[model samples]
Target: MFTGLSAFPLTPVTDHGIDEESFAGLVQRLAAARVDSITALGSTGSYPYLDRAERARAARLAVEHAAATPVIVGIGALRTRDVLELAQDAQDAGASGVLLAPVSYQALTADEVFGLYADVTAELSVPLVVYDNPGTTHFTFTDDLYTRIAELPNVASVKIPGVPADPGAAAERVSALRALLPASVTIGVSGDPLAATGLNAGCHAWYSVVAGTLPEPALAITRAASTGDATAATAESERLQPLWELFARHGSLRVVSAIAETLGLLGHPNLTRPLRGLPDHDRAAVTHVVQQLELH
Candidate 1:
């Protein structure tokens, strides 16, 4: 299971195809920074936007350049068979583990979600991380459902999104989850803005979006929180409040892509069409935040 900061890099695309050079550079940068792990084909990576071939290529490239760093590939698909195939491809590509989310067009029942993970887990060689992002999946997991999934074979961790507005409530929720889940299963939190609160709440890891470009600060926050240094962690989190505000206003995908482009971390910040980059105003806002933070 992945612990600490798992940086999810954006999938830098070009007019032709995946920008291999830029993608590899990003992976190398994360590896150099010594992020706990790297997740390719994540939401930030725009996994759903790309075809299977593109996703497979991205997985291979991530694993290849990740060096000693463990790589976790997102194998989320609407269909069970597609998810299974992607999981197998991730294993073949030398990925350390796979992240699976219950994604569906029609609303999914708890039983269906359980069956999806049960079937996928039975076939996978590596461990699976259960992704619980209701915002996108539209399928929320009750505590009972999470307990059932945690009992599944090879399910190592659960990635829960934090409630940024209510850190106290989020901490209590984390405590409840910790009590419900087995000791072996790690609990990680996503949604970068909520990370400090989540980490302070005793989350084992932070699945961060900003860490994809500016890992130093992200790691600093996580490290402080993980070590029980509330003062330091809160200070670091406050320091990045400007960038987090941008993430809250404009979506993280747009703002982070713009920040990466502005920082020259990626060759092009172009997202797969239909999903566009930040507009001029938002781009200016992100640029100002990045410069103010001296992120570049």
Candidate 2:
């Protein structure tokens, strides 16, 4: 249930709040494309920026609109109490699994992070993903921690921040993780650009940001890589290098918001306060990249 091409859609919020219409449309589009899974409310979904009520509502909309595809809801919160609440909300909303990042203000020790997952996993009826998102969450996981967490009940996957770019290195990294993790706990690669290398190297899943908006191309890469067509998969990823470059420059969240707006998938200025859209010139660059690449 936690493997392959898990698209993380933007929880496109407007001034009025969670744009149910647009967010639902994004989820529906992903379902239609036959993505392996739809992961709502990841970092790309701006989970940190939303309130509990908005997140619960978005989780419901995602499940309601997701059709037959499995829905995995991001349930990360600064506090364990709130994380547990969101996980319950996700289960109530019919999520196949829940993603948890040890969101923090102060630096969290390995024990603290593990304790967070331990506490939440103990309460979960559904499978839980250990969201090792150091970029946003500012906490990294050691292999020792992964082994310990994998032993927890209902711990299903580890969404690693990324893998090495070189195929050999990626393979080595994945193999090492596989050695530590239980057979049931899948390893999913999160960084979109290295998804090809990771999958080709034997990672079980691609927890993607680009796939959330432009699923076709992301699907193309995933399908190619999973089928053992490593060349085609790498080619497809390279083809979308411009988008990846934009992601590197403006961040995937902002760049994808621009793509969504450019494609008319969502209205402009969809992000919340303190998080703004791309500048006009950067937006124009996104438009050009979209047109040049014939995305959508």
Candidate 3:
């Protein structure tokens, strides 16, 4: 459940609220592609913007539509009590695991971060993936903190943000982090553009954003890497370099929303208020890239 490719699907919503049908379609698409797992309400899902009920609904929809694939729900919230509630909601929804990042408004000390994990993990019955997404959480975990939190019960995997760009450096970094963590806790790499590099360097899994909307290309890379054909994995990822460049320019959330919209998998104004999809010109660029790359 924690390893290989865990696709993070966007939670498409409308003025009326959760778009249950579209969300289910997204989950089902990933499941049909046989992604290693489905993660609902991750940062890509715009989780922080959704209320408890909405997030709970999204979790349930993901689990229900994901077929036999494992589902991991993101249970991150600003408050510890809320995080616990979300965790319980995910568990009740039958999530195979839960992904948690230490969400906060104020700056949190390392001790506070560690305490957050301790408090939440104590209440969690299912396995927990330590989400180290500094991009959204604004809380960085030191090696010492990772060591401490990973020592707690139910710590199944560590979702590291990304690895170094240079292959040697990436390998050494993952190797050193691997030594710090318990063998039971797998290391999954995020940052879609660097996924191939990280996996070739030693990451056990890829927590991908694009995979949610387009699973075929993602599966190609993951299968290649997992099967020990690192060259094929790198080539496949490089083949999608245009998409990665767009993700760098417009932010993955907006770029992916555009892709889903372009592909007609989601409706207009699908995102919550104040967070619109890409502009017309940018979307035109996306269409050109999608066609040029022949992305389905």
Candidate 4:
């Protein structure tokens, strides 16, 4: 079972290319922190911005540094063939699994989405994680579609983004999905803000962004929630409310990049060009939250 926290680190970038040293350092840190798994080339990794070669290199580097820790590499692409090739590359790179989100230039139909996974599953030998992050992909997965995808040969887990507006509703949704999925299909929640609620509602794992930079706090919430301690989980969530507000105001990519820079996790928190880091004011806000939480 793919349970517990899966840390998705920001892909550190330098003028020349991927900051390989810094990237390895981040992965090694997460491994030392004992995160259940690590995901490279994920949304935060800026996978879409990189070319095929860059993505492949990032996957290999992550797998190498991850050592004993399992690494799940994001293989999402707009085209079916591209996704298939990336999955094969990930498997060859020694990744434990591959995560796929139905990212499309045009909105995809249900059958088209199903076909995409089916084709990839046919090619991939590693476990497949269905990433239902409609916020970024603009491709929502219906329960029927989820069930269909989960039935695929190598589909082992689904990363469900939380419904942030109403955590109660999100918890209920998690419970419903839990009942709907097969016993072998692990239900993990992304959307850092909703992780505690999702776990309390019985999610087996947390696909976390904040954990990439601050594993301790993220782990605290997940551990408490996983053990059925709703009070402790809620408390930790409340403590992170300020940071969550920033994430809501700005996207996590911006806030998390800023936090990473503030903590000196990267040489600089430079994301791929065209996607800049947070402005001065927002960055100050992140710094304040990090200090208040004593995350640094």
Runs of candidate 1 with Cα error greater than 4 angstroms are none
TM-score of each: 0.97, 0.99, 0.99, 0.97
32-81 in candidate 4: lDDT tens per residue? 99999998888988888887898999999999998899999999999998
For model 3 the TM-score comes to 0.99
Candidate 2 lDDT over 99-193, as tens digits, reads: 99989899999899889989999899999888988889888888898899899999999999999998999999999999888899999998998
lDDT (Cα, tens digit) per residue for candidate 3, span 9-59: 999999999889999999999999999999999999999999999999999
> Model 1, 49-138: lDDT tens per residue?
888999999999999999999999999999999999999899999999999999889999999999999999999899989999887888
Candidates ranked by lDDT, best first? 3, 2, 1, 4
lDDT of 1 at 71: 97
Cα lDDT for residue 165, model 2? 91
Which window of ten consecutive residues has the lowest lDDT sum in model 2? 133-142
lDDT, model 2, position 230: 95
* Residue pairs in collision within model 4: none
lDDT of the structure predicted as candidate 2: 0.93
